[model samples]
Target chain A: MRAFVLATAAAAIALGAATTPAQAGATLDAVKARGEVVCGVNTSLYGFSYPDDKGVWRGLDVDTCRAVAAALFGNAQKARFVPLSAQARFTALQSGEIDMLPRNTTWTLTRDTANGLNFAPTTYYDGQGFLVAKKLGVKSAKELSGATVCVQTGTTTELNLADYFRANKLDLKPVTIEKYEEVTAAYLAGRCDALTSDISQLASIRANDTPNPADHVILPEVISKEPLAPAVRHGDDQWYDIVVWSIFATMQGEEFGLTSANVDQALNSSDPNIKRFLGVTPGLGAALGVDEKWAYNIIKQVGNYGEIFDRNVGKDSKLQMARGLNAEWTKGGLMYSPPFR
Target chain B: MPTVRWYNNRRVRGVLYQIIVLGGVVALAAYLVDNTLHNLERRSIATGFDFLGREAGFGISETLIDYSPADTYFHALLVGLFNTLKVSIIGIVLATVLGTIAGIARLSRNWLVAQFATFYVETLRNIPVLLQLFFWYALITEALPVPREALNPLPGVFLSARGMRFPEPVWGATHVAMLVALIVGIVAAVILARWARRRQERTGQIFPTGASATALILGLPAIAYIAGGAPTALDMPELRGFNFTGGVVVTPEFAALLIGLVLYTGTFIAEIVRGGILAVSHGQTEAGLALGLSRGLVTRLIVLPQALRVIIPPLTSQYLNLTKNSSLAVAIGFPDLVSVANTAINQTGQAVEGVAIIMAVYLTISLSISAFMNWYNQRIALKGGR
Candidate 1:
């Protein structure tokens, strides 16, 4: 009798999975019905996505996933993290194992267009660079040729290292490993002459991982453009729009100088854009199939872009990356959000 | 309608059972295929072998073949496959020889040898392979001197954090003659063995076949060496700028992986061999010794031939296990199949195809090994049991 019941249940699940087609609005309804968003993130990337000492997930990437949940359920903690490595991240997202992947993944043309995914707005701008021991006295990449470099095996950094060397016509030896921790271990153990990864990662590792932070210096050459962003599976436009606007709302918040602490003050502002953003008018939230306070909940539960950055990766954190290319358009930087009004 | 008999009804029920089982299998296969196709279509993810030809755009740390970052995904995977084979093949031979010795030692008369063998098997088999790999990797990489101050372990060998460098053989014209001499010596030894066996059967007198064969092989090679002017020289590695550039350097990754695999597999192989040897009857050994044979002859002539029949099947599984376990090479950064496939999947976003290729390669290797083992097992199985 138990065997009969198990067979029936298995069949039901198999049938349900088989018919999960691209039916325009399926994911949005599923997220609403489930009452939580399943978020995939990096297992251990400093500043972008990593667990704090208390085992709380916290990062710029973590906040992006949380903001999506905040917009949906008015609670940031509604999103649960499934830690993933670079090799497994895409499949985890594409296979519907997770509702979204907000890991520190660089948005490239092949990933954005060729892969079965749509990338949200850039959360953090990054570029490929090298980190070397300060004792080597190598000021720039040009001085280092035929060097043995260490990199995580499955990351874009591994591929980028190949490209950088091939483009420069330098003979480089790469010591690639499976996990980020192993790469760090190998680099520290002096198995390779240097370590290469995203510039942001170089900063995080140099600043936090090393015993003497001053002993290692990140090289000045930025080899490749790596615009890291959150990505969702394609074919769910409504869900995609929600994630995009949720990310944009954080950027919008930063542009408006409305932080998590002062969001209530902005709620009563007479400025038309602030009123619209705070959902004094409810159409934008309704269009994305959420509560009128979607953007408001995002800022309230998770902080806006600047607050999230400062709390995790930027000025207040160990990474301490200046928002250079990440600064707003009005400040003569590249970040520009679509108007809310 | 005519009433079916009870026995006839049993046949009906049996047919129904077979139909149901077959139906279930077909349904499961169809469901999986349908779901995969649906998922791939929904995501617009490409499905095919088109990506294999594209530039892998990645570098492998250790390559047995001439590989560069410009190679295709297929080439990278091939390199990975070869690397895995290289480690597994060498590890298997080393494990078998070590295991056999350890297994025999476990049953040795000397208490120290017995205890040592037991200690090695018990301690090593209990610890995880990954941890062992990490321990070995860390032990070498951490303890070795830095590149600038590499330790000269020998006149030609340099040990450093980067790797261990040894002298490389520079072959000359005489190498071809040496190869020819080896082949000729082997053929001569085989013919001599057949002739001696025939002569021994007729005269009831055993020739010193083993000693004669060894002399024919090694002595002929020595003669060829002298005749060909011994045109082989060693290119001793020396520190140039940062590292020893011109020699055979064993990377720390490869060494750690190889040692970890050999020791770990050896423990299991030792247990299997011990079990096989114990499966042999004590009466068979006593009978050979009672016929005025030495204990060595009793083991070699009576016990081992039987024990091997029992050992080969389990030993085959051990070899397969070793090959599959080599995928753990990724954990320590040895470029094996799984690691290279992982990079391919990440770079190309062809997880399904990449995974399929990995499975196929491992399957082929396992199937081939099993086939050879089965042929060998058939050759050794008792033709007519007593």
Candidate 2:
């Protein structure tokens, strides 16, 4: 009996040691060899990661995932979309379940450091806000003392609510529901006085509201800064830089007026910065351990940041959210690319 | 010599089989643990339970105990466990009463009553619990008007998108005395029931035990109320500006979760009750009737005893199932143990410890329920028969 137990223990220990670190830091290398990127995305947030009628996933976040795939494989469709929830997203990334997460996740200090994950450039600058019925006659969140607020569980919104209420010295009661759908339901049912979430989410919710959406008003309270960015598991600086540069490449392309529709026309341009950005000139991609044509592939196959955003969330989409803080640096928004030179 | 050899061989084989099974289980467990550790390490992720002591920088929506973002993961877990228990206990109590009424209605001679009971069971049972939770939380609740435009159900009650707000009584000495009387009345009813049973056995006579017990319970509380200062005023909910000024409010999350759980679990309980009642033989009722017993007597004295034997076991399982299903509150963000742990895990990156704590709590709750049911089943079980 003792010998049998010993033998089993030995076998288990051996197997554990063999497979643990075998695939750890080699995820980026493996992706390059396979010529495809696996990007995790939100399963069901409108304008972020929802699917169209034809079952093709398209959204602002999904476009970022596609851009990364285009940069790596020269074909945007080569990326596999892995859907994840707020609870399952981090673990999936750490376990190598997906290569990158473009799931509108906030870049918190804990997630960036303690969680062994690194976030790329901020894609969207957002803040927490509340949506309430206009019939309540409340113009600002400060007037919502002792009112019940519905918030989704397991998100930054929960803490942000606490901070906002505490800072305002308001004694607000929070009615926590679990899913994004539940928060919407409770708010719509008049079971909660207000629904709190990101300002962008408020826009989407208001757009999808039944009856006349004009009956509801989003309060002017942008509490807690939410800088959402794509994240990769830590330990691979090469993978980190690849995703960061991919995002910057899109912004840089937009700055140079190179759209997916105009990329082919502008390919023979004489401007040094445009040529360097399109990889007509070498060295930039090689510096990031990728080919020189990486930026050109991203713009040609996936379009630039503005095109992706306008298609998914701006005036053309169901969520007609205007570009506020998400606009380019020169255009008075926070989005700025590091010098492409 | 052959008989002795057979005995020795049987013992040896039993020992060898036990060893092999034990060894296999240990080996499998060890392999999994090792693989998990290796994977975590290679990914540069720390694998340990030390994260439980770390601060959880997230707040929960509805918590029974005091919790803040500054609290440790351990405290957050406690709050989650408390919420789970709170919802389950209320759900169990409400489901039992609702199920009992519906079950009896299904057996009623009235066609409308029976059909209504049947419709309820079929409709609720067919739909998934998570979907039902969403329906209650979102669609039903969100349709209500804002607080300023809330429809007043009564002078002291307001119904709005925020939730139902009603009056809360400010308790005094008289209230405490009345509460004590209610407790005493329940004790007296139990004693009277035992006395009535003894009297029935001693003489060939019966008393209206049910009526007598009900009167004892209600009458005593009434007497106490009068003696303990009868005019108790209600502190009604008053609408001020845009919201209610003073009232005890039940948050929408609690209301939605409670309603969803009870509605979903009550259907199963109703079916269980129906099955239990049907399992009792019709002959038992006929025999009671033949003995000059009334219809109510036939059911209460003859059929119910047998039906209870079949009912208790399944009913216990349903209660346990409802308790476990309460964890699904995560779907609608109910701040239950599972949801709280999920937040803690994400904020702290303590997946290993968070999941372990959640599993342990649920397993403990399951075992406790099973143990209680086993004890109850033994007490009611028929003795010494095949």
The model with the greatest DockQ is: 1
User: TM-score of each candidate?
Assistant: 0.94, 0.89
- All-Cα superposition RMSD per candidate: 3.2, 3.5
After superposition, the stretches of candidate 1 with alpha carbons farther than 4 Å from their true spots are A1-24, B1-20, B240-242
lDDT of each: 0.87, 0.82
List model 1 lDDT by residue over B1-386, tens digit each: 88986536878667755765666677688788887777777787777889899999999988999999999999999999999999989999999998998888898899999999999999999999999999999998889977878898688898998999989878776777788888999999999999999998999889988999999998888898899887658988876544568779899999999899899999988998899899998998889989999998788888988999999999999999999999999888899999999998888888888899999999999999999999999998998864
Q: Write the per-residue lDDT of candidate 2 for residues A127-184, one digit (tens) a residue.
A: 9899988877789989988777878766788878877787777776776655576568
Interface RMSD of 2: 3.7
For model 1 the local lDDT of residue A9 reads 66
Tens-place lDDT digits, model 1, residues A145-230: 76789999777788888988999887788988878888898888888778999999889899878889999999989999989989
Q: How accurate locally is residue A203 in candidate 2, as Cα lDDT from 0 to 100?
A: 85
True contacts kept of each: 0.65, 0.53
Q: Model 2, which residues run further than 4 Å from truth? A: A1-22, A29-35, A208-214, A269-276, A313-327, A330-333, A339-341, B2-8, B44-63, B66-73, B195-209, B291-295
